[model samples]
Target chain A: MIRIENLSKSFTLHNQSGVVIPVMAGAHLAVQPGECVALTGQSGSGKSTLMRMIYGNYLAAGGSIMVGDVDVAKASPREIIRLRRETLGYVSQFLRVVPRVPTRTVVAEPLLALGIPSDQAHARAEHLLEQLNIPQRLWSLSPTTFSGGEQQRVNIARGFAHDYPALLLDEPTASLDAKNREVVLSLIEAAKARGAAIVGIFHDEAARDRVCDRTVDVTGFTPQRAA
Target chain B: MTQDQPLLSVRDLAKMYGGRIGCTDVSFDLWPGEVLGIVGESGSGKSTLLGCLSGQLAADRGQILYRGRDTRQMSEPERRLLSRTEWAFVHQNPRDGLRMGVSAGGNVGERLMAVGARHYGDIRETATDWLGRVEISAERIDDRPRQFSGGMQQRLQIARNLVTSPKLVFMDEPTGGLDVSVQARLLDLLRGLVRDMGLSVIIVTHDLAVARLLADRLMVMKDGHVIEHGLTDQVLDDPQAAYTQLLVSSVLQV
Candidate 1:
C-alpha cells in the first residue's frame, strides 16, 4: 500500500526579464493493493509531478509519502533508486525504450539493474512477453523497428516483467489503436489479477471506465499560490 | 471533383527512392470546398503520398498543378510562399507541426506574422478568435503547446493551420494519438468546421470510421498505388479492389 499527504512540488520558469515564476502545489493521493486508480486532469495539472513524487523521482517539498516502511519524501537518492528497482514499476506517456537493445533484454533490464543473473532475468522476460502475445521472432530486435502499437506492447511487457507489486503508468494507451488498446488494458487486468497495485494516468475516459477500479478527478484541485 | 482551374491537382504522382516505390501514378484534385480522405496501412505510402503532393518529398515523375500552373516548375520562393500563405499541413503529432517552446498564440499566429501581420493586438485577437472557434479556452492562449492535453494540443494545431485561411489543407492522422471519446469529439468539430467554413481538406487516416465521418470521398492506397477511389460510403460499404476490401474488413469485428 502507498499513502500520500499534503504533497507539494514547484518548478521555476524564467520570464523575458529573467524573473522566475513558480508553478505546482499541494496534491494528495493513495493506492492500495489490487486497487487500480485513475488520475485524470488537464496538461500541467501536476498529475505527472505527483506520480514522480510517489516514485521518489522528485523529492516532495511539503508532505509525506509512505510506501510500506519507506518514507519516500525523506529518502536519500540511493535509497529511492533501490526502492524503485525493487518495489515499483513505472511507465511514461512517451515510450522511451532504448534503441538497439533487444526487446527481451530491455524487458529484463530492470532485473539486471537489481543484479539479477542474465539467464534467469531473460527467461522470466521471455515468459512474460509470450504471455503478452509478443511474437518470438521479434524478441531479439530493438523496439525501434516495431510499429507504434507494437512498441507500446513491448513497453508494457517491460514494466510488468519484473512483477513489481506496485505499477505506475502514464498515458500508456494514448498512441495505440482500438485493437492494441484492448490488448494493453487486458495485460493490465492480468497484472491486477496477479495482485499488482496499479495507478495509471489516462486522458481517455472510456479507458478509465473500463480498467480503473477507482477514479480520482484532479480538475477541481485549486492551483496553490507561489511562495 | 476535377475542374479546369482546380486549386491543386496531381497527375501520375509517383515517388521512388533507391528503387523502393512510395506511391505510383497517384492523381487527385481539390476543388475549393471538397473534403478528400486517404486511407491505408503503415507501409501503404499514405503519408509519403501526402509528402509528395505537398512538395515535402520529391516525386519520381508527376505534374502538380496549382491554379493551372505547374508547381514542379515553380521557384523555391514561390513554393515557400505557397506553403506559408495558401497551403497548410497538419501532422499527426501536434509537436511536429508546432514550435513547442513558443506560446500557443505565437504558434497559431506565426504564419500571419511571417507574411506581414506586425500589429501585436491584431494578432492576439485573431489567435484568440481561431482558438475560440476550435473550442480552446481564451486563457490558454498564452500557454505553450507542452502545457496542453493531447486533445487540446491537436485542436491548437488545427487552429494554427486554419488561422491562415489557406485554400487547401492537408491533415495526416490528426486524431491518431487521441482517445476514443476525444477522437469522436474532434471528428465532429472538424466536420462542422469544414462545412461551415467551406474549406477544402485532404485527410490521411487508417480508420474507416474516421473516413466515414470526415470525408465526402475516399481513396484507398496500398504499395504505392491508389487501389480504390469513389464516394466515401461506396468505397467503404462496397469496395472494388481486393486491398480496399481487406482494409475495410479488418476494422469490423466478427
Candidate 2:
C-alpha cells in the first residue's frame, strides 16, 4: 500500500532571484495494493512533481509518502536504495542510460541491483524488450541513438523489469506508438493482477481508462503562483 | 550454469610472466549477483587471473567481454571509468586499497568524487554512512587509515571500495593478515553488506573456509588452470575432481 498526505513541494528558482514557486500543496491520496491510480492534470499542474516526491527523487517541503512500511520522505539514502531495489520501482518521462552502454544492459541493471543472476537478468531483459517490440539488432546498441518511441519502450522495459511492491510511472506511454501503447497497457494490467500498487500519469485517455482504477486530479492540489 | 548472456565473459584468457604461465585458457562467465570464488595455493594464478579480469593486467591472449563488449578493445579511459564507477578492487593489503595519507572519510569520499559528486556535505554524509555500514566507528572518520588497527584499516578499505555502490567488486584475500576473531567478525559484516546490496563479487582466497562462507559457486584452480567448478555446497560436499576432493578433505581434517 502507498499513502501520501499533505504533500507540498516548492522550488526556489535561483535564476529568478530566489523566487519560490509552489508546485503542489496540501495534496492527499491513498492507494491500496493492486490499485492503479492515474494522476491527471494540465501542463505545469505538478503531477510529475508529486510522482517524483513519491519516488523520493524530489524532497517534499512538507508531507509524508508512505510506501509499505517505509516513509519515503524521511528514509535514509540506504533505506531509499533498499526501497528502490526491492520495494518501489519508477519509470520517468525520459530514459537515462549510461553513454555507450547497450540497451540490454540498461534494462538488466535493476534486476542485477537486486542480486538476480546476470544470466537471468539478461534473459528477463531480452523477454521484456521482445514483448516491447525492440528490434534484436538494437539490443546491443545504445538507446541514446534511438527514436523517442523506441527509447520509451526501453524505459518501459526497464521499469517493468522488477516486480516491485509500488511503481511510479510518469507518462509511460506518451511517445509510444499505438502498438507499443497497447503493450504497455497490457503490462500494467499484468502488474495490477500481480498486486502491484501503481501511480501513473497517463495522457492517453484510453490508456488511463484501461489501467487506472481511480483518478487523482493534480489540478485540485496545485496552487497558482502569485505575481 | 544457466543459459543466459553472462555479465562478464572470458574466452581462452591467458597471461604470462615471461615463459611461466600466470593463467592459461581461463574461460568462464560471471553472472550478476553471483559470487565466483577462485581458490588455489599461492602462485596457482589466482591473483593473475583476477588481475586480467579487472583490467589491471593485460591478457596475452583471447578476449574478456564485459556486458558483451570486448574489454581488451575498450579505450584506457573507458576501462578506467568502469573500474572507478562500476567495478571495485579490494587488495589483499589494506595499504594498497586505502590511501594512508587521507582521512578515512576522504578515502571513501574520493570514489564519490571520481564519479562527480561535487557536494561536500553529501559526500561526507555518504562516507560516514558507508563507514558505519562497514563497522567503522563514526568518530574515526577524520583519522587516517595509517592510524587505525589492521582490522579497522581493512574495514575502512572495504568501505571505500563499496561507497560508490558498484555492481561488481573484486576482493583479493579480504580477510588475510587479520586475527582469527577479527576475520570472523569482518566476514559476518561483509556477508550482511553483500546480501543487502545484491553486489556481484569475485573473491580470490586461499582459505577454504572463506570460500565456504562467501561463495555461491566454487572454481578450483591448480597449476594455472581451473580443475573443477560447481555450486559451493555440491563441490564442498561431493568433491568431483581429485584435487577438489583433496582440498575438501584437507579442510575437514583441520
Runs in model 1 deviating more than 4 A are A1-227, B1-4
Q: In terms of TM-score, which candidate is strongest?
A: 2
Q: Measured by C-alpha RMSD in angstroms, how accurate is candidate 1?
A: 24.9
Clashing pairs in 1: none
Which regions of candidate 2 fall more than 4 Å away from where they truly are? Answer: A1-227, B1-4, B252-254
TM-score, candidate number 2: 0.53
How do the residues A75-187 of candidate 2 rate in per-residue lDDT, one tens digit apiece?
75445656777999999877754345689978987887677888999999999999999999999988988999999899999999989989999888897888888899999
Shift in Å, residue B221, candidate 1: 0.6
Candidate 1 docking classification: incorrect
lDDT of 1 by residue, A2-109 (tens): 787777664322222333333444566788888799987778766776787687655455788887667888864334545677888888754554345588887887
Residue A157 Cα positional deviation in candidate 2, in Å, after optimal superposition: 38
lDDT of 1 by residue, B159-205 (tens): 89888888788899999979976886687677656755667898999
